[model samples]
Target: MSRAIEVILRDEIFTELEIEYPDDRNTNLLEQGMDSAGFLKLVVLMESKFNIAVPDEDLLFENFSTAGLIIHYLTEKTMS
Candidate 1:
């Protein structure tokens, strides 16, 4: 799921920024280059691709900080 999310982020969200996917899954994307707009794009893409609605409460930075966190959040949501 993380791999797929990486592909979507690279191909769709980060394409305009020309930002490469980091080698470290734990890397903070915002620190690297991602802006608020890019972060929102990622959230929207995740919703569309995963068919999951991210609640307002889950909009915290921690949940969207890294690839692994995003995958884990979605996995937890689906499991619930």
Candidate 2:
């Protein structure tokens, strides 16, 4: 699932956002040209693709700051 999420994020979300997927999954997306619009797009894509609604409280930078973190968050959300 983590690999799948990484692929979608790299091939779909990042492409739509016009941002390049970093070589390092732990790279900070905000530093990689991900702006507010990109972040919103990411959230929307994750919700639709994962079939999970992200609560407002989970909208923290730590949860979405990097690809690895996003995958981890989605993994936990889907499991619960």
Candidate 3:
């Protein structure tokens, strides 16, 4: 997987938001503050790093609600 998203995401988004991963739990990110912009940025970053084209439709809450989830999705996508 591309560490680009993880590095940028952690250093940029989480730090800027002053959000520490409180618990080992959280699935719904939109409820927190990761709105459409974050989702769109992530989609772009992933696409660029992986050399894959991710349709805008894939940038849904169900797909990118969390970093781990996003990683999982990308792993699956790149392999198949």
Candidate 4:
């Protein structure tokens, strides 16, 4: 799932943003050039791709701050 998320993120968000960065899970997405709009789009895309709804309370920076975090968040949400 993490690899799939990474590929989608690279193709959809990072590539669109023209960002160049390693595929490090701990890499900070915001630091890598993802902006507010990109983040929103990512959230929407994740919800759609994973078939999971991210609750309002879970919409925190800590949850989506990095690629790994987003994958982790989705794993938890979907598994629950």
Best by lDDT: 2
On lDDT, who's better, 3 or 4? 4
Say which prediction, candidate 1 or candidate 4, comes out ahead on lDDT: 4
Highest-TM-score candidate: 2
From the highest lDDT down, the ranking of the candidates is 2, 4, 1, 3
Predicted structure 4, TM vs. truth: 0.73
Residues 1-80 of candidate 4 have per-residue lDDT tens digits of 66676676667655655666456889897778777887777778778767888788887777788878877776677677
Structure candidate 3, residue pairs in collision: none
User: What lDDT does candidate 2 reach at residue 23?
Assistant: 91
How accurate locally, in lDDT, is each candidate? 0.72, 0.85, 0.63, 0.73
Off by over 4 Å in 4: 1-21
- By summed lDDT, the worst window of 10 consecutive residues in model 3 runs over 17-26
Q: If scored against the real structure, what TM-score would every candidate get?
A: 0.73, 0.88, 0.60, 0.73
Over 1-80, each residue of candidate 2 has an lDDT whose tens digit, in order, gives 77887788789877877889999989999889988777888899889877999999987777899888888888888888
Model 3 bad stretches (over 4 Å): 1-26
lDDT score at residue 60, model 1, on the 0-100 scale: 79
Q: Which one wins by lDDT: 2 or 3?
A: 2
Clashes of 3: 0
As a TM-score, model 2 comes out at 0.88
